[model samples]
Target: MSGMINLIKMELFRLVKSKGTYLTILFVVIFSFLLFMMSSSFGEQSKANMLEEDNALYAEITEEEEHIKSGGIGFVGVDFTRDTDIKFETIVHSFLSSGVFLIFCGIFAANTVCNKYKCGFQKNLSTYSNKKWQLTASENIAVLAFTVTEILLIVFILLIISVFYFENFRLGSAANIIKYMGMQAVLYYAFATLIMFIVEVVHSKVAGITVTCLLSMGFGSFFFNKLDEILKLNNFLVTQHTIVYNAKMLPIAFDGELWGTAATVAICSIILYNIFSAFFVSSRDMA
Candidate 1:
């Protein structure tokens, strides 16, 4: 335990002092904010369009709502509001907030692991009286810390927009949001470690990062109306968390809780990532 602590502590010091971790977090925050701000004008136009679509959707539902009420499926006097349609704006808000979790974090964390080789730390670690698991734990801790830092910076940028740009931004029942973010932190470490391990094998940061980005982009666009189909197929893509904007309305969905899906995905991905990482790290000579 003491050795693990020392190992993790050393790893944290090394990562933090290097400034790459901090720069990654800062870049995610600032870049996400700027990206959103630049596109917000178009978003305003889109919002108007979405509101019109929402009105049309609700209008289409009014007759069904009244028919259902008359038939005893609902109370007779409950007049449905035309404004109760799906707010695509909320989803847009979420997307603008989460940023490129897959692409950005995947690149950075993978680099952190690969940087070990570049900086000669992997060679130096051979001289330390440390177990492989302890060292893995250290890297894991370092990656996890930066992951959370990156996510919190994201949340901060969201709050900035919510307070300044929008009105009536009542963030109700945001427990889901927090749960989703916590899940992302876990998932990021798992996927990042996996990429890191692969990077070490490939021994090329550019190639490793390029492949990660390609994979993330490919899987990010797989969402559909059939939730089961979407989630089932999405499970294979560990970085699917990058594109998920919001948890579906709960109490009515299976595999819709970002937390649940994220937990399962993270667990499976982490297991696979760690398994290969273990085999490789233990067997490979330092570069």
Candidate 2:
């Protein structure tokens, strides 16, 4: 336990000192904020355009009414008003809707193990007191990294909410949002660790990252959705569960079955990936 704690501490220090991690975090933050700002600006512009059209129509109607009153025989015009239909719900969840958050985080996950290799940290770990301890320490550190990443995400979300919304911005329930974020953190960490395990097994950073991207942002979700649709296997598909579980985080009635499937798949992935990573890490020659 003490060794694991020490490893966690060391890993946190290493991550904090790593420029790549900081750069990735900075990129995600900037991209996410840009997305939010652009969407808000577009929404406001749309509303303004609608109002302008309404005003123009009203002017035309009044002109026609004056002409008719003067017996100038102008055509009749109808009154019209543009109602603001901007859905706060859409704005509040724009981060998820934009797909930027997920993509950036998924890419970060793909690079986790590769970054370690590039820094020669993995090689140093091979010289640890015990080979098993090396893998164990790495696994714990991966968890710590995931935790940090998730916390950063929560912070980003809060910052966005504060900036984009000031009044009437409280999501359905504050408690629910916090709980939902906690659930998302667990899911994201499991997914990231799965990528980490893949990187360890392949021993090729490029290959590992490519596979992670495919699984997280590419054909993996597409094919999984197709399979679920054709085979009625939604409960067992990880990608499907990921989508379904994220939906449950919204301010609406939750689906128990989807939540259950998501929980089951997340737990299974966490267990299976870690076991496989440990086994491969133990057997592989570091020399």
Candidate 3:
């Protein structure tokens, strides 16, 4: 365990030295913040609209309570029908915010895995200990580090927008944002692992990344669109089972079989991928 952790630390240090990676993350942060700020304005307005409903559902609930002088058995919950509308507005704004941010996360994953090999770090990394097991471990560590850093950074970006754009931030809504963040994080983690191995096998960084993005968007949507049947293989896909850990965002409920199957697929693919990729690094002549 200690050996693995130490190796991971070294991997993180190497990533820190890459100017392109830093620039990419920073650029994404700026872009996400700007977009979030814009979207949050709408969210704030929606919240305000909810407050203006004094003569709306809440008021009706009050009137109902007065009339229910019958045994104190008032139908209070049914009176808040407008809560449904507020919930929908929140969902719309959240979807927009998440969509924009996830694009950057996918790109970031592509860059981290693809560029690491494209730039010749793989061969250099092997010189220290080229054993396939060790090599795979190190690569996984590197990708994990990059993944965690970018995810937390994205969360911070959203927090900034929530504060600056919202007129009055409600503590309860924070869970929603957290949920989305966790979902994206889990999905992207699988993506990074899958993309790294996939491209490594194909031996074409650009080709691998491109195919991944297409498949993720195209197939992932299909899975979501037809959850009753399509959800059967979600765990196998890695993109399917991740639920964001936020209060404001709706939680995702995944089938256990789907997650188990997808996880197995990804795990097996990762093993074979490292094996094939090992040949290129261990055998190739490095500069």
Give the winner by lDDT. 1
What C-alpha lDDT do the candidate models reach, one value each?
0.57, 0.53, 0.50
Query: Where does candidate 2 stray beyond 4 Å?
Result: 45-99, 126-129, 133-168, 226-239, 242-254
TM-scores for the candidates: 0.70, 0.70, 0.58
True-structure RMSD, every candidate: 9.7, 12.4, 11.2
lDDT of 2 by residue, 71-178 (tens): 222111122112323333333333332223444445565566666656666666554536454554454565546555744564566456554564444334444445
Q: What would the per-residue lDDT of candidate 1 be over residues 249-277, giving only the tens digit for each residue?
A: 11111245644665666677777777777
Residue pairs clashing, model 2: none
Q: Which lDDT value does model 3 have at 217?
A: 36
Ten-residue region with minimum lDDT total, candidate 2? 73-82
